[model samples]
Target: MPKRTIVLSLKDQDIEKFLEYITQRLRGSDYSLTYKDGRIYLTIHGRPREIEDLIRSARKAHGDFMKIHKPVAGVRRYPKDWLVERSRGISLSLLIRA
Candidate 1:
């Protein structure tokens, strides 16, 4: 089955890094990434477990980044469970560290 994920970002470099991050982590999964307007559409042909793993990994990475960089003022840091809930069947906008 193919799962679609949407990522909203302004910079192409960020999107590129996001794709590189995902590709490096999920080596076994196949991905088709494209950008339309201001959002990135990524289609992955992988298992449900893989999707969950990807989201979980992203959450961890975000947490680690926050620990080092400290989130900017007014930036909301979502709870772990909220991140999982927001996945909504593997569809979400990535929180990239800037």
Candidate 2:
């Protein structure tokens, strides 16, 4: 199966709190969290159901934060190699904005 990625952009928000919340919500799931270019990347290599569940958790987190902070947060998905391209010095700013 193709890999999947969930990209989260949180501007002017509490990173620690968001990380803790997402970590708790995604317990037992196959995922890795990383920070790069001012964004949080959640890379999931799992079954489709697992991916769906993760997306739901992300939405819940978004909603929870929206109620409290309403910070500039964007939750997006991208091809598995999006990170790879970024790492290889590719400009994805255009893609990101789209």
Candidate 3:
């Protein structure tokens, strides 16, 4: 089944690199990635476990870029559970380090 909607914000210049990295990681996976309203909305079609793995891997592997783009103050983190609400049906809300 398709995963819940996820919106990612990437500066114009960063989009290329982000897409390159994501594509490489998800080489065999099918997903919907689009740019709209200055955000990259991605919907991954996979099992819940698969989605969890993807999110964890992305946060661990590609998170370096996230660090570079973080705010001047405070820390950036991913919650223990990406699923924010039961009604949302296991949605992963990705807040880019920006």
Poorly placed runs, candidate 2 (over 4 Å): 71-98
Residue range 1-98, candidate 1, lDDT tens digits: 84747453435445555555456655665666678775666555568887767656554544443433345685656555445654666634453332
Candidate 3 C-alpha lDDT tens digits along 1-98: 75855667668877787888678766786677899766887777789888777666655534655554454468654433322532255334443322
Q: Against the unseen true structure, what C-alpha lDDT does each candidate score?
A: 0.55, 0.68, 0.63
Q: Write the per-residue lDDT of candidate 2 for residues 1-98, one digit (tens) a residue.
A: 54577788875356777787678767887888888776888887778887887877776765565455543455444443434445566556655554
Better of 1 and 3 by TM-score: 3
Kindly report the root-mean-square deviation of model 1 from the true structure over all alpha carbons: 11.1
RMSD, candidate 3, Å:
11.9
Model 3 regions more than 4 Å off = 68-98
Better of 1 and 2 by TM-score: 2
User: By lDDT, who's the top model here?
Assistant: 2
Model 1 lDDT, full chain set = 0.55
Give me candidate 1's TM-score against the actual structure: 0.44
Which residue pairs show backbone clashes in model 1? none
> What stretches of model 1 exceed 4 Å from their correct place?
58-98
